[model samples]
Target chain A: MNDVRSINCTQCGAPLELHGGHRTRSLNCAYCGAVMDSHEGYKVVEQFHDTLRPHCPLHIGMQGVLKDVEFTIIGLIQYQTEEGDTWIDLQLYSPTHGYHWLSDEQGHFIFSRRVRDIPKPAHISNFKLKAPVFLGKQRFYLYEQYRAKVQYVEGELTWIAKQGNWLNITEATAPPVCLSYENSVSEEDYYKGHDAHTEKEYYYGEYFFPNDIYQRFSVEKSAQDKPEGIHMAQPYQPGLTAAMGQVGGYFFWVGLLALFVILFMNADEQPRLKYHFNQTELSTPTLIPFKVEDPQKLLEFRISVDRLTNHWVAYEMVVQKEEENVLIVEKEIEFYEGRDSDGYWSEGSREARALFKLPAAGEYSLSVLFDGGSQSTPPPLFVELYEGVVVVRYFLLLMALSLLFYMWKWFHRRSHENRRWEPVTEDEDD
Target chain B: MSTSPYPAYNCAACGGPLTLKFRYTKIITCPHCGAGLFLEDKAVKMRGLESVMADYPSLFSLYENYAYKTQKLTPIGQVRFEYAHGFWDEWWTLMSSGEACWMSVDEGDIAIEQLVTLDKMPFMPDLQVDVEIELLGESLRVTERGSAQCIALKGEIPEVIMIGDNFDYVHLSGAKGRLVTLEVQNGNLFAYEGQWIDPFEVKRL
Candidate 1:
């Protein structure tokens, strides 16, 4: 009995035992009752069973099981007796197998081997009711007669077909029907669904056969292969507008943003001293009087305000020179906002127009007053220099364009020379 | 999504169709009414309502509540000299809960920020302000509620008065204790001297 016994329901932990009569045998568990079989041993069932079956607790989805099992649901058979007890029959796939009055509930599909989840097919002839339909979590169906064409494009197998007109079919007619296969089905069974069309295309991902349908019409899939000036996709399409649009807008906006950033950075970047030192003063060891290359350019100032009173109090600037013995010719601070007339303040109103040129090219000191204690709050002030930055920028731009033009000329000349170089070809060797 | 099926009124003066500007508070008036015949609640009220609401919509909406109970305002203080003032019973919406409630307001220490029915107004300080809303026979309190404050001004900011990210408005006083309003407008927060500078003007500036 122990040798004849198989483990009971492994999932819910039920014991199974032998049932039926002496003529016909069945496996039934007594402790946690689950009736499994009537036949004594294993038997061959059906074809579709090879691809899909009931899930087994002992074995996982794709693993092999001990028995050959197949079954089909045909119809629901019912009966009623004089005692008023109800009975039913399930028209199964095989004729020899018969099950009787078990319970009031409908019967379930059972397979000896575990069922597997199938992979999705690349193409399908029909969009609706397509496989693999999940009968249960594990059980699935590949369905019946449908057609698809599988061709190798690039490294992947993609399905494609010639337009129906090429097949001599009606203008409105579609191609032959195809079946979508569950992954458990063999590749040969998958190809059987592919109709024999010589003009049909085969694709594996993006790559396709040289004579494929897409290739035959000269369709270019990538942006690098696209020719200049033609119909294009929306700005969002991958190769058509996406690439060029991004490059166009990206460079434009990026250039604009970069310009603003550069201006802001330049504005914020403040022409800081890469290195500041009194070279002549250090060399000669003087207490003061150092020469500066451009005394007009050195304007390093910091503004401080009283936090409590919210007042602009003072501003301090440090100036350096390149040579000694330069006298302080004249120097005065000036301020303005919007334009010169909106509000203007200088060291002295009368001498405001006088140019404060350095006498002998040496370091000098300058300071300014935040308020002369006037009732009218002078508009926000920034130290203004007579020299405009536009001249320097224009000069730099001209210098850069000239350099780029010459560099481009040199690059083209070198490339042309290199291509023109010939190591005697076989025809030329003669 | 609930739709009001009631037929709207037409301006009696101009013969133009009148639409409800506020939810239940109906001050039906024609735009061509030439700024006269102000409708507070259901009654024809005053003349300067157009200018009053220009500076404060929340205040005008709340003031209309008094019209509901006594049918008008009781003449009080300075208002008694110019026009009649009264208090009435009406529902004021608590912006935080989106529910209509009864509240009250008085003549003294009237905080405009506290009286607002909705927090959608663009103002300054941006802190949750205590509102004074006048309701029917009683006053209800809705606290820590108001829209995000956004103000604008012109002139100068001496210290590192950062805007956005953390603070909304910084009240700074310049020379002579002159109050200057500074707020984030467009992107830059400018410093302006007078309260007379309109919010829209500051935005444009």
Candidate 2:
């Protein structure tokens, strides 16, 4: 289908190459500023004496592969908004995919195509900022509205595009994807028997990075434009650091699961030994012996006194592991109860416990001596030893470290999204 | 040069030799004189003179065999219609399996369609853009509604086609490239159920 046909410019007699298909309506001469009607045997429809060529990287007849489809650049239209901001749109045509547009503004590129599925509400005039618009199953928010006038026209177009023709464009974005509604009122409808109606069209666009366009079209490195600021439709690209953050998120869940497993496995409620000492033997030290099975797990030693109301008991104990002093501590267990105006209240505990890990799985002895109490005579003291307790503080520290990675990724994504909507927020504030 | 297996005839208007590529062909235009001829009870009769279609680079040509994916299609006749914005060509094609279908070409957009009969007729006046309708168990949305006139005709056609006849048409689109086109002409409605075909996949044989 790439049968290259050439024709001389109707006005300047300069040679021109035709690359567009049968649907091409008009051709604007690049060498001589004359617009010819392509349908009517290349008749000169209008002419612009002095038109300055716009700066664009892509030229007519240049072929490139976009989305696995090979398309040729057939036309170029430069448009300027009322604020004097200008952008270039290159018309692309493929034998199978029909026509598409590649737009360049502020060094950012977007590939767009006319879509037949109409957006909800259909008209741009009914659009409100941040309002939801549905196109098929996808939902988009109204982003921006602007009027752009044609500043320069070159090559062949499907419609008779001339200089100064304007279009009112309303854009709605769902990030990386944008839906635009374009409305134009043309004086020349060009049909034989139809009333002139305002032309309304919808286009679906996807944001393309500068490098992607340059690589696809084989554009020179020097011709690549540096992208400035953030585009409204640009999706955030995660870097290596953010990827590590995702790994951290997985580690956090794994660490939590490990903590729960340790807790469940170490939940041993049976004590190794329970011993009691009478008041007569309280003056002398009593030795209680227990056997340790797992040295990696913690051992708990509990001392308690019975029937010691509004009084306290003092005890001195030493834990020995096979003649080696593993631990030595002095602890007091006190209980105080009184009837107040509000209700019965209690203070302190009747028991105290100390935890320690043994060096080896062998015999461990707890020697306890009851010192004194408020009753002048000390109550009977009971000593209990329990093995296989879990240390929960260590697991908490590990989980906190793993969570930092997930938080890092979350912050980066949030920052990128915030910047994308900054302009919309500013407009709302105004 | 009539090596085709189908029946052949002579043009009643210009005495030019004509060939039928399909069995159900009722109208065949003389390639020499561009005359629209009707086949009635094994007799050829002059219907009208078809206008010469302008030469354009198209994916298919009259009586040309093409391969669309795994299916081989041979275009037997073509009818061009002028709509509000532009014109599209409907090529009546016969498949390798001996089944006949219509391939509609508008610029680069192409669709392979087959005529279907509906149990109930739809009210054309009630149809509007974006309206949902069910046909042949599939739901479709009306995408476009307009009127078109038959400006050119050529080769063999299954039904009567008159030049300068205007017909109201509606295009409905469904999921996964499904399309249904409805045409109303002279108080008669015709339905075509089809799927959109990629032009690049169609290769000339």
Candidate 3:
């Protein structure tokens, strides 16, 4: 910390402590509203009476570490737009990094520093809404343009700022980072023309959360203001729900991979039993014997009939182990196709499958009996039984739930971005 | 009689004892009468009385040794220049390696630079803010262009210091904190190239 310098106001004789270094051009006396020229020896350059001191959480000489650099709050200026929207900008000075600004609009804070590099098409008049503005290699979109008048000032500033001094500000943002162009317009310039150029400055700003600001400056919770709306430069903060969604996204891919692996592993297996029968053979109950080697694995019975358009077939089967019925299954296979106004349409399938577990590894006989059909005589059908099949319906269900979870977070982030870029009207600002 | 290791001389105006700390010192102020003196062919000549600067917080003091990063520097002389807005101080420093450099202090901003020869000189009247100029094969943009008058002087300076001498200066900046300062005095041009130094990195020795 540097030593504090004090001087008596030339107008009201009130002692004012200077917190800034030699670059400070003006010091506004809080006691008498006298703007003193710091460069030319504390002379009263301008005076404004009855100017109310604006409320600010941080005071002059308050030092804090921002972005690993120690800075002291040297000055504060409050600005109000014609529509009554107000914000406060604090001038921060560091011995090494020089001067910067901390802007407080409502509860949001943005840290900005003057940049020497000029942006292409330096003036705001050449800018369009949402058009890309290039500063060096980085690109930004125009965010807002407004004219604000200085309402109050205290401590010291790099430039002389009198009350009612108007400034035209143009802001462009690329999320969490923004570029600002400020043109100071005095009353004389305004009377001359709106395009009269005065002092032009460019600043690059980064958004800071309210909590981060409070914690950085060690301000009390009571002094903190509640954030009302989304700040233009505020980056999307993924909350706990969004984190969960990201985790779900990972799981969704894992579930799909697991389903693929199961299908790949089951691809080379040969059926344990294969049976062919005609419609005449199924007129009565026919027995087909098959031996099950592994009772722990699941058994799949697949039945398919020859192509029979606009026809259907149904059958019932009983699995018996040593004359004792272990499982009874019923299935139907139907194929129907026709042309519609939109396109060719098809319904049903020619194949049906059933899954079951055998009680023991033993010889089992399947008794097949024709139940019903579209015709008096059913078509010939083929039956195949396989073991060690895996169910993929559970994996599909898991994937569906995971995708929904992730989409929830994605939509939330999208909405936040939408609100951040939403245009503000005069009524909305009020 | 003097115990100083460097060459010692008598002030031209006051006949006070003076010592040249650096090999390239061209001008110095007499301690007794504050008269600015210049050295020509082993003879000291009087220039004029230098104005004293108002006291303020500064990072460097005349004839004070300081450590900046890995290099040790001693500020032998200081020249204060008053511009339209404010004034800045340029300290002619003697480094441990026997090299002389200039440390410019404007507000809290500081830079250490040494004189460098450029292949092409920029036209003084054509220079403006945001204009790009090539210096030592590097493209630099003019960040500031202004004229300043010397307000005060102290200690030994490598360049001739005349009180109230005005010079137009242009500050050009490039990538990675590179700084190039171009000063036009009378009709001659001087250029210095260096990087901006952080004041916090300097420690008094």
Candidate 4:
């Protein structure tokens, strides 16, 4: 056997030579008739032997970063390029799905006709000039043309390119300026809205160029350093919380309004729960008929409170006089009670139908208390001792405070959950 | 005429000054030398219709606005950029994601595909793959494995290529070892790649 010479072509899979033939700067493949020329310089590829196959072969999803004249693989490729004198075609999948013909010319691998039908992350495109491009989950066309310059920093791949820029057809065209910082009248203030170094300025909400290129393009930031986007956000829409706040606030005031209305509207016949000392228990056991002169005087005894039960009711004590000490009997009195279906107050007796009789009298204290449990929880009980400029003002202030406390707790819980969830990883299928 | 980059139009076949003609292109045909001299970029431009020439395959993409519009074509070999659209949008309409895209000769047609699924691609065999990642101006051989093989590196990947999620494909090419950078802006594959791929097949490919 004449030793078959065993050399192979890296591009078209043609046989290559081992020695003298490669020295002329241009070499001809015996089989494929391809002319390989070195612009800067060239390397002679060895034969495709079993041992070499283990060292240098192309595979799928194989990612390669640009190295000095050589591509160092970072991932993998799914398909191989049709062999050219100095190029190899491949299909890549990181930024998007597409095909590329990678060529190794002199000390550089040139990529051409690489197609992608997907969005990519924020990065500079190798085929375009320096600009921030958005890569996401959308169908877009991207073109990148770059040469290989191998330099590693802390074991990281880094290469410099002369020129490259790209275009995104479907993107919103422009991004609004984000200026979350402004107005301190110093360097500290300017740094807030401006990244200083990384900050990129744009003319419209549609395009972003380099910060220095503004002389050629239209670029402006707001007078204030408030980071602004195209969409200005509004206060949170009244949701269950907001609506509740409105209702809470409305009824809170309305409830307050209703409380004042009950106190004042019934100025003539305020539901007064007076402690009538029973004549049978007193030494002066005379049955003296009692008449109320003005109902507005009743407001001085009971307090109005709001409860979840959706109605206003009053609670007070009925007492009987015994020499010097007073007896207590707690009872609830709903303002709506004792009223006919037509909502008119019902009369008690024949002689003076609207009149109520008290057997005896003594100084008494009025206390309003809430009735705990039943089909409905009792309305908040408010006991008014003195009805005047001082008492009424103090009562209203108390009600306002209680409403604010409830709202603050609700909002705090909701905001906490929004920040807790972890964002999805990059590898998972979107 | 602009000064030619080369010294003489000599036919590789016969060592003689060949007369340039557009038999179809800027090929130096030696009426005397009888040798073929193909000056790729120059010859194609001289033909004027170089703008109309279909250098690569015309792929019909139902994904973009101009899904199947026809025009000239060029081959952008391979460069990484983010496939910045969603899977469906990028693959079908060129919407959403970013991808590391490159050109591969399929039969006679050139097609663009993302690099994420390339590892399992039926067409890509189990060849040895060596990966180098450039991060923060640093070059490092991050992964070297067989097909379907993966290697974890320590540098931050501003973005990674995924099957369903969009990503970026960095285009690496430049003088010496320094690679130039460019981006795939938007819509119509051939028009986009045309910016980078040389019109002349001889010099570019």
- Cα lDDT, model 2, residue A199: 50
Query: In model 4, how large is the Cα lDDT of residue A214?
Result: 21
Residue A399 alpha-carbon offset, candidate 2, angstroms: 3.3
Q: Chain B alone, TM-score of each model? A: 0.23, 0.92, 0.93, 0.17
Evaluated on chain A only, model 2 obtains a TM-score of 0.73
Q: Interface Cα RMSD for candidate 4?
A: 16.0
Question: What is the C-alpha lDDT profile of model 4 across B69-164, one tens digit per residue?
Answer: 232223211111122110111111121232223332222223333323112112112211333444224442222121111111111111222222
The deviation in Å at residue B122 for candidate 2 is 18
Q: Quick one: ranking by TM-score, best first? A: 3, 2, 4, 1
Report the number of the highest-lDDT candidate: 3
Worst 10 residues of 1 chain A by lDDT: A150-159
Ranking of predictions according to DockQ: 3, 2, 4, 1
Off by over 4 Å in 4: A1-430, B1-205
Selected candidate, larger TM-score, 2 vs 3: 3
Global local distance difference test of model 4: 0.27
DockQ computed for model 2 against the true two-chain complex using alpha carbons: 0.17
Docking quality level of the chain pair in candidate 3 = incorrect
DockQ of predicted candidate 4: 0.02
Q: Which has the greatest DockQ?
A: 3
Off by over 4 Å in 2: A1-5, A48-50, A186-197, A253-287, A294-394, B1-101, B111-205
lDDT of 1 by residue, A314-336 (tens): 22223334433332222222322
Distance from true location, Cα of A19 in model 2, Å: 2.9
| Clash-forming residue pairs, model 2 | none
RMSD of every prediction? 37.1, 10.5, 9.5, 25.3
